[model samples]
Target: MTEKLFSPYQFKSLQLQNRVVMAPMCQYSVTAKDGIPNDWHQVHYVSRAVGGTGLIIIEMTDVEPDGRITDQDLGIWSDDHIPAFAKLVDGMHAHGSKVAIQIAHAGRKAQDASQPVAPSVVTFPGEAYKEPRALTTEEVVAMVHKFAAGVRRAVQAGVDAIELHGAHGYLIHQFHSPLMNHREDVYGQELSRFGVDVIHAVKKEMPADMPLIMRISAIEYADGGYDIDHTLQVARAYQEAGVDIFHISSGGEGPSGQRKPGNYPGYQVPFARRFREELHVPVIAVGMLEDAALAQAVIGNEDADLVAIGRGMLRDPYWANHAALELGVSKEHAAIAEQYSRGY
Candidate 1:
């Protein structure tokens, strides 16, 4: 029987062979403090691509230096960074695994001691972030350009897709989540408009064939975090704004303990499914979607269209192939680099 995990998912341009997607993870490796792609990134992503994962979403890349979360985050605000990303793309494509890049700005979550900016003057629980200087209307408009340019760099690097980082209290998240965005401007009043503008603007620069995914933490995971009900509305708005897949994540800002009770495998699937049922668009269910059976159930039950794996993929890169075996089907590690194969 062809299991749910083995089924194909069709985005705008590429066809993903399996419902399993490698979640974009921050490895905290950066070279020259420019957020440029380095060797660490090359091996990290290519390893997973070759390990039989379906599509790999690269880590959160800074659109500008001030948007960085730390000294080690990847960046794509310039043309120089594209060359390195292109190499990473070549390796990923060699393994037959499609790739996506998550472009972001850290908002108030920028590097320690450096003045970080956000829609409001907020601070993460215990992270080292400088007091942010709120952006003027002109600066806000400039941020859009920076974000759009990141898409161009990713496209030049030959990636198949691009996911805007709108979760976890980053720049977009700051705008989307009311708990963080305390501004009184047009950007602040419209919950949907905060992220929609950038997503829509980015579409212009991104490859037409490339699918654009909006990765959002459906719930802000804080006491006064963005409301889930409102987020559902935001989900619909993004679809209208030209998003291809809704990658649902949860919690990053405010108090983490205030999050909804459950976080087990497939726990977050319902949120993704709800968006899918309501919006009728592709949704990638993320967070703790580890086990093969759990992942299978989410897709089999029509709970979500895709399962995104983070720690699980790190725990075992050959998860997709193994999952295929358990589900009584066939999948290959053809994406794995030849050098890493045992019998080479």
Candidate 2:
């Protein structure tokens, strides 16, 4: 029988050696604060490629400097930043791993910014968070262009795909969240408007065949947060706006209230299934899917088209290779690097 976890998976222009995905996790190692990826970023990602991840989604790369959670996060706001990203993309490709970048804006979550921006003046729930200034109607339109510009750079850098960070309480999420967006403009009237606009703008910059991925919170955990039903409506709008794949995750809009995020393995898998069944689009499941058997079941059970391992990959860079071996996959099928074959 073919082991679904280790089986090849493809969608649009993205073809992966296996179903394992290295979920985008912020390294916050950009010491230069100039938004350019440096040596730390290169070694960090390329090592994962060497470890055998099929798809390595580069960390939450912000579209603008102030859009970063901290000054240390990666950014693609300028033409000057393209080469650094291109080099990283090349290294990952050389290891036979496909690459994707999660373009985002941290919005009110930009803790280091002197003044952060969001759809409205509400502050993210934290003592460290500042009350963000609201973007004027004209500035909101300009922000869409900024997103397109960032995606254009990613394409030039040669990423196999692009994933927009519409999840978490970032700029996109802020615009879409009823808790965060108290605007009186058209953006306020339609929660998905900002995300749809950004999606359309970025799609224009991408190749017609290249798939566009959007990471979205399927449910919010904060008090008064929207439920899955609400997100389904929002996601439907996104799908129509040209999102080819959905990376299903939940929460990050604010602190958990009555409905806390689950703490068990495959907790988020059901959400992924819901997205797949309802929207009829491929979805990637993330959250605590580290165990080899469990990850395999997520695929074998047809819960998600792909599984993203965030902390597991961080703990063991060779998680994919190890999982393949544990699942009884042959070395040839596992594609373990020749240099590491003896060790396996």
Candidate 3:
């Protein structure tokens, strides 16, 4: 049978040469602390593009300076940041890869922010984490605009798609989490309200044909954290608000309790499968799926529409190319860069 992992996939205007995605992993390499993409990021991502990855989701890029987890994290808060991002986007496109930016706010996870903010006054459990100040109702409204502005900048930078960081205890995740949000307002009453609003706002900034992807944690590992049932309800609201794809991930909220996250390959595939089945949308499954055959199995088994490789890609920029070789994809479909043809 033809390897599904090597097959092309498309959603809206974004088309991928294969079903492999380089998952958005924070680089934390912005030395200037100004949220600009530097040479380090350029080479890091472009190398993967050359390596034949179908879709490259740029790292967790913040909407504001203080919204970053650290000063080193990338940000798209300013129009000035567009040129640098556009350069990266252009580089990726030149190599036959479609690019997406994961727009996010670290919220209470902003370790360097003197006053990190969240849905309520809850503090993320960590020595480096601070007690986050609760955003006033007005600030919440403005925050949605900030998210939209970030998406606008990303669109201007020529990203093929947009992934709102709603997972891993980020700002959007904090708002939707019952444990993190304990306010008496509408946002607290309606957990998915904040995410839904951000989706609506960002959707307005995006081209009508551009797909809006939302990464969500299917289940939180923290004690008293939510389960898949609650997240499915939240995702339903996001879908209604206009999320075209769901990237299912898990557990960045806090420390694990009795329900610990699995530490094996394909462990999270079930969650991705569940989300796809329930939401009836294309979903990206991400975890420890580095093995070529395993990655191929994910697509062949219809467990996920796409598989995102994080640590695997970090370890090998040419992971997709190598995986293609391992899976015996034909040269015509393998997409190996001509410059590296001899090596392959």
Candidate 4:
């Protein structure tokens, strides 16, 4: 029987051999002290490609030095960083996996910066995160160009797609969250303005057929945070701005509250479904969806077009292969690495 999890998916000019995507997770292994991908990033991603991951989105790559959550995070601030990433992208392509890199600015969450920047001066609740200075309208405009520059570099490096990290309380989220953004300018009047501008700017640097994925926290889960309806409205704005796919995730906009999200499996599947049905767009479902059966069910039931396995992929670089085995996919469709075909 054909397994939905192992089936092919295509959108725009990007096509995946399976619905399994390796969610971007930070490695913090940049020993070079520069924002370049090193041996660790190469091995970590290539292993997933060999294991049959359909798509691998590199960790949150910052557009500026101070935009990183940690100093060790990967960056694309300059053309110098492209060659190292290009090698990894080429390797994944050789192994039958598509590659995308998530470009972002940490905003107030830049843990290592002496003073981070955000739409407002509000800092994340925890002491671990430092307070952030609000960005001037001019500065915000400048930052949009910086994000555009990052996209140009990614295209130059030949990535299959690009994802903007609009979730997890990053700079984009900060601008949209009412609790965090308290400006009186156009960005404040139009909550999605900053992100939307960034989207348009990034699009200008990309090929017409390339997919642009935006990951959004569909629910805030904190006290006084926006609800699903509110997030859906903002998502529409992003869709209008040229997002081709929505990767649904939740929380991280702020600290927990009485209305915190549940920690159960497939907790965010509903969010993904809503984006797909309501927004009329392809969606990637993530959040504790590690079980082979559950991942398959999510795609089979049409809850999401693709499933992103985070911790599961980290724990097992071959999670896709293992999932294929568990789902009883045919050997020909499994496409297990030739060197490791016997094990499968």
Candidate 5:
């Protein structure tokens, strides 16, 4: 039998309903500014869960104020936001989906309508960027605290797993990228130190049984920025720090990587496949994957342990259910949250 997309895969302890992970795509429809979760969040996520995604990873939520990409990002730093997210998570679980929260600090990529905030005050050749105040060492320490508190809230909200958003030039990733982090201090000089401190704090606060995954941009796609060499090194250390999975993505290539290399099916799988061998960790591959054949091929070839679908699901919310039917996925797997009598 061909391994189905919704097959249950055991990751140490937690069981994911399927390999069809809903990649964290920003919806930008939060409570706005306050970083609170509201009805919008509840509906947006539940829709995907209801649509038959195996794992419904929530949007890129902020761990702090300056982390907001726009005024519409969801936040978990405060306990007040838990009830709404709890409802969302509960509803998703009720609909038969494992949930993962993709949490991050936006760092210098913080933006308003037109202005972008960045680590150093390097003007982007006339792109109205915010003159970000370099975060003090004390402030950095506080940010770590915020991440721990956010995880606690995620646990309260009842998410099945946690995906630390360390990719795409966000706060944690910005520090990891040489182009963005220009500080001469430890954070700036030591490109890999920031993520370590974060995982250290997060691990301390998390329950031993909960699965923690790192969502990372394995390549910066830019020449002067983060590259495969640096990212692989970071992954080695991160696995040692105890993450259960590595969610791989690309871009933030600065300028050189901006060539619109038209999206091809599994365009980014090579990175994940390489990381799987180098890091020896479960890797989640996300890119232009849309077909069941291609996804099966990736998993079958051991290119990646799992495949993450973004636009494909958006194109078809019931992508997993239908794909499961076509690929003949098991209906009795533990990862199957709750199966609908009829396909979406």
Candidate 6:
């Protein structure tokens, strides 16, 4: 039987060596204090490439300094950041892996900002979080432009794709999640408009064939979080606004709730399947899907087009390589490095 997990797949202009994707994980190792890629970022991502991650999505990189979740997070707001990212992109490509960056704005979640901003004057529920001031209609439009600027820099840095961080109660999520957004303006009247506007603005800077991926919280696990149907409606709107693929995750809109899912392997696979079926678009499944057999089953059954390894990849930089061997697939398929081939 063909091992679908290791099979190559193409979308738009990207061709992956396998179905393994290193889901964006924050390193927070920006000791340089400028948010530029240092040796740490270079070694961190390229090691995953060497470890056989077909695609590596960098952590939530902010478009502005205040947009960062923390001052230590990566940023692409300046032209100087391009050269560092370009170097990282080159290293990943050298190892035959496509790379992407998750452009984001933390909004009220910008814990490092003296004053965080959101669509409304809501504060994230926690002692660490402070109340955020609401953005004016004019500022909302400007935020869209900030995202567009990030897109331009990422493309200039030669990334394989771009994934907007629209989930996890970030700025985009803050604009859409009714639990946080309480504006009476057009942004509030239409929940998905901010996301659509950002998508449209970002698309203007992208090449015709370059794909745009969106990471969305398909179902909120909070008490008043949006349900599957409502999330699906938002996903369809994003699809219409030119999102090429959906990376499905849940929660982060609010604190945990009665509906919060238990921590289990492949617990979020059903959400990916639902989005793929209902939206008729490709979806990437994430969350606790670290088991080789479970990930294989997800792909073999066509539950998702791609599987993102979060903690698994952290535990083993060669998680994909290990999965290839454990699944009894060929070592060549794993693209094991010549130096590491003996281990395989």
- List RMSD in Å for every model shown: 2.4, 0.9, 0.8, 0.9, 2.7, 1.0
Candidate 3 residue-wise lDDT at 71: 96
Greater lDDT among 2 and 3 belongs to 3
For model 4, give the 10-residue run with minimal summed lDDT. Answer: 26-35
Q: Give the TM-score of candidate 2.
A: 0.98
lDDT of each: 0.81, 0.93, 0.95, 0.93, 0.76, 0.91
**Pairs that collide, model 6:** none
Model 6 quality (TM-score): 0.98
Q: At residue 132, what lDDT does model 3 achieve?
A: 91
Model 5 misplacement above 4 A: 30-33, 113-119, 123-128, 257-262, 328-344
Instruction: Give the RMSD in angstroms, all C-alphas superposed, for model 2.
Output: 0.9
- Model 3 misplaced stretches (Cα beyond 4 Å): none
Off by over 4 Å in 2: 30-32
Q: Over the stretch 171-273, how does candidate 3's per-residue lDDT look in tens digits? A: 9999999989998898999999999999999999999999999999999998999999999999999999999999999999999999999999999999999
* Model 6 / residue 115 / CA error / Å: 0.5
TM-scores for every candidate against the unseen true structure: 0.93, 0.98, 0.99, 0.99, 0.90, 0.98
> Which whole-number lDDT from 0 to 100 does residue 184 have in model 6?
97
What is candidate 5's lDDT per residue for 61-174, written digit by digit as tens?
888666777778877878888888888889888877888898887766677624444445553322544656667767777787888888888988888888898887777777
Q: Among these predicted structures, which one has the highest lDDT?
A: 3
